[model samples]
Target: MNWYVVYTKPKWEKKVAERLNAIGVVAYCPLITKESQWSDRKKMVQVPLFNSYVFVQIEEKERNRIFEVVGAVRYLFWLGKPALVKDSEIEAIRSWLSVPETYEVAAEQWKKGDKIVLESGPFSSQSAVIQEVKKNHYVLILESLGCVLKVNKKEI
Candidate 1:
């Protein structure tokens, strides 16, 4: 399978994807859940990892299948050719999608944190290491518990 970038009309990305999928075209729109705040309230929405474009996995020969979808203006490439997303890049994306939540970290983000478990739960006495930094929680590996724990760092 090959990955091609599709250009959607304005905010027609979701519309283009739906129409494309209905026509038997395989399109992969990486979805990331995020907290969006308006003037009155805050809500969550699953937004496209890349705005206005989606990756498609399909055979190279079936080019016409792409343009057939409504709101799909054209493939994102120079000189009227389809662009291919690297296999490694897509694999990295898949790895990210496997997680329940995601976070964007700075360059100086600490990887190894030797923090004492502060909660009054079962593993409260355990000293843990930070497994990963997620949006709402930090994944910890408790030495005494011999298990992974996801606790909200903010709440702690």
Candidate 2:
């Protein structure tokens, strides 16, 4: 079996993964936990690493079965075929999610005013400029959208 990417309804990655797994499909939806702060309290929440996408390992003959699951919209086709993801890439995602401390080291080198792209979370693939760097976090400006975001250091 090989891994293929599936497009899902917005904010439905977790649901699709769960449904696929319930049907005996090996599904993966990478997630990261981040602390969200409000005026009075802070709490950690699990958020999907990639929005609207899930990975499933299955034989080609099982494609129809996967598509029948609700929230699973379509395959991420490349050159007229479903794109295959290598095991190494999936393993890398697993490793990254498993270790939360490694993010500090990876994020330490970015300087102020540096151009950064969000690889995960709600802003996945969105470009932003680093406005300020604080301990384990960054103040970023999404110039295109005229919005400011405070993101975990590791997530940028």
Candidate 3:
């Protein structure tokens, strides 16, 4: 068996998967829920990670029969031949993106114009507003203005 990419109409991946399954064609569509908020309201919706694409697992002989399905517009290929995506790679990404793992990102401080100074560190002499703070050290967004920069814990 091999996997082939199928391009479906917009927002129709689930529908295509359902159709394929009913016809005994194996299909995989990984979905994720995303939240969006605006001044009016907030909504949570399910969206496919790979837009307009669905992966189908099928026998070599079923190729022609599967192609006739509606919304199974075309196969993703390279050099005029269908490209097969490894199941291991797909599974790896699925596991990696899963929320079971724990990760912590420290909060950021200081805007572009805010004054900053490193209270105690090798970079003490330099001062800059916290453009962005990663594991440690501020990006110094306003370094161009040349202000007295101090990267204190409070301004980090």
lDDT of 2 by residue, 1-156 (tens): 899999999999999999999999999999988898999999999889999999999999988888779999999999999999999779867865775443332467777999988776545567899899998788889886688987775555
Q: What lDDT tens digits, residue by residue, belong to model 1 across residues 1-156?
A: 788888888777777777778888877777778899999999998888788997777788896688888777778886766687877667667765775452332222435575654334434345778878766666778776477877654432
Which pairs of residues have clashing backbones in candidate 2? none
Lowest lDDT 10-residue stretch of candidate 2: 98-107
TM-score per candidate, in order? Answer: 0.59, 0.63, 0.61
Q: Is candidate 1 or candidate 2 better by lDDT?
A: 2
lDDT (0 to 1) per candidate = 0.71, 0.85, 0.67
List the candidate 2 regions with Cα displacement exceeding 4 Å.
Answer: 37-41, 102-156
* Predicted structure with the largest TM-score when compared to the true one: 2
Give the best candidate by lDDT. 2
Task: Using TM-score, rank the candidates from best to worst.
Answer: 2, 3, 1
Among all windows of 10 consecutive residues in model 3, the one with the lowest summed lDDT is 147-156
Off by over 4 Å in 1: 78-81, 100-156
Residue 38, candidate 1: alpha-carbon lDDT: 100
lDDT of 1: 0.71
Q: Which residue pairs in model 1 clash with each other? A: none
In model 1, state the lDDT of residue 89.
69
